[model samples]
Target: MPTDADDRVYYVISDLHVGGDEQLGEVEALPELLAFLERLERTDENAELIINGDAFGLWEITSVEGTDKFDYLTDTYPRLFEQLRTTGDDVTITLLPGNHDHELAAYDEYVDRFAAYNVTLVQDDSFTRRVGDRVVYFEHGHQQDPNNRIEDWGNPDASPLGYYYNTLVTSRAGQLSDRGRYNWLKDVQAVTPTERMPVWLLSKYFYREMNPLLRYALVPFLLLFNVSAVLAVLAGLSLADIWSTPVEEGTAFLGQFGAAGTALWFLLAVNVAIAGLLLLVGIPLYFLRRDVRKTIDRFGVFETTLTVDAEEPYEKAARERFAADEETAIYCYGHTHRPALSEVDGGVLVNSGTWLKRLHRRDGAIGVLPPVFYPSYQLCAVRIAAEADSVAVEFEEIRKPSPSTEELTLTERLLTLGRKPDPELPDRAEIPNGRSATPPEPAE
Candidate 1:
């Protein structure tokens, strides 16, 4: 709600990560975005669309520099640019720079270039808009993130920890993605918490890139690994005269099937032997790993968890803002790519989520297989407007099917049969005038 206009509406989205090099340049939700923009163009309401942050994957565009990156994006996504131009004519459109697209703030040329397409680029880290009697604070939410926070906000040379990560890992993945068997390396950005990327790569390599013959040959051994370890333990106990031999009984049962049974028993014996050797070695390795971890802790090598707790800093900032301004009713942002809405003090803390593909990790039901990263789409627009005596916030999802069939191998699909992600969002929430009601339960 704008103080000057009671009917004004705000639509917010973030982390589009639209522009990149080669395979990374692919925008999976481009159709939905185009349709959304067209709808905005047709709307009669007084609307303002704000791209909270990381709208462009400027960090992934390593081939170009400065405003040339903007040129590349415009040329590459002419349709999207046209839609933005059309939508901007009817509704005010604002773009905020996030960690990936920090170059937008670093270069003055971006302001003019984006304006040519009717996108008003906001160079500051955060801004506030009045909603009825209260105010809503808007930011990309990267300032509170240590890895992405820019010490010199608008300085071109101000590369944070996240900058190098995008350069070396994300961009490189884009350049090399097509070389992979399934062309999936470009999705390196979708793995949340950043720490899961290595495991994700291993999973993809095993399921998609590994040789089928080798994989199948090893499947039986892997599937029976735990059973073999137990059998090996029982065999050791029998050898030590502490227990009867279950291994012998099991092999005798198998031997009743003749040559095939003998072969199966031989395989089992080999497996047991290997498992026993691994167990003996693993015992020492486990202790060694613990000692190494302790030493690393002593040296303070990893002071923080792989996935930083995104809630603490942002919530702390929200609390501070609430304490400072009694009129502030909403603190909305989008950098962590998690769509969430909950009451903070009397106000609501909201995350806009992302337009990019989201990967939900699903552990293997059994065995030591790497976890499958189930892909899904959470394309959404967060709408905020006036609602009588209270401020209303709503999350509207743009439905789109995930590319699991194309992205995941058959094994991955079989392993994660019934565990598809179905994330819940609070359909609509109200920030009361009194600022005392509990937040509504998230929609089922």
Candidate 2:
């Protein structure tokens, strides 16, 4: 059993694309993050910080060129690095290269740049560390994705959409310049539309279709019509009232009753018709839309999966080569932007989730401004503690609060945005590493 003194905690974070197109939320979270680092400095002295991957959106800047990328990195990432350095002077910072920043795969440049900042660059897909008696493994989880799997041939370089876009269509420049060699193929092929067309079209369609003003305008009419329709149905059912009343009373009652019946019946029919229409037409449309979305999502999944799997052949070879060596407890990785903690036959696996804020389709019906939900802002970490004859693993979230609307002033907004970073709380820890360093006992 490993002693308590040997146990250690490590913080893992990923996908902090410091200088990408969507920098708003990250920028907002910066001050709070700085403060959080200060707090960490004051507190957790022994913990190492592992930045899983995609720290920089290098692919985005490749076409743009010099100084811009450097300026952006210096302006944003230095604050983050400086704080980490100040908080944990002895702390080792391990950075795994991810797809977005695949340049890290070329280790020399990364080592040179990040070493000065006290960040160690890890070029491999998997890394292992020991705390007490526990062996922990880390990898970015993209290997599990199908689309980006490295096994896929001729995928584009590290950019997110570029892989699928390039794979499915020939570049215009290639078509034009390589005419002689590819002329036969080009002559038979259909020209691909702009890569961005589908996304742009969907965004525009959703914005106009889901407009709140239209929903609001229809709401009152819908309500009034429904009410009238209900009353009309009730009146129609009350034929006795029409037949039994005196002349004067019957005349007045019949007029009101008939009107109500007519209104009620009209509304009921309209609602039924609408519902029927929806069932017959809207449901199919809904399914079609979902299918389209899934198709697009699958493209992304394929690229991610392919890239990871391609790298896996080498990993598998290494594992086999070292099969007779010392048994390892866990395997953890975070380069693929997927979060997972699972026990495997030989070891445990951990994937630190990404810090990239995923852009979801905006829905205008919910608010004055369209609501853009960022799906991937979560920051996660793991703790490994020594138990009797084993080690326990745990996960945590480093949550930050949303900015309050009451604080509208510039100073107030900054202050609100700068609230203390929440306590790094674990979600689940204590799932034992399944396969022990020792070989399993033979069948009893």
Tens digits of per-residue lDDT for model 2, 167-191: 2332332234333321212211111
RMSD versus native structure for model 2:
12.4
lDDT of 2 at 170: 27
Off by over 4 Å in 2: 1-8, 22-25, 43-45, 66-68, 149-212, 219-264, 277-326, 335-340, 356-377, 385-388, 402-427, 431-444
Could you give candidate 1's per-residue lDDT for residues 1-444 as a string of tens digits? Answer: 223455678899999999887899999899999999999999878889999999999988999888888889989999999999988887889999998999899998889888888899999988888777778899999888877889999999888888888988899999999997888898888889998888998888888889998888876668899888988899899889888667568867897999999898888788889999999999999999999999999998786654556688788889899889888878999999889887788788899999988999999887778899999998899999887888899898899988889888888888888887787766678877876535878654
Please give the TM-score that candidate 1 achieves against the real structure.
Answer: 0.93
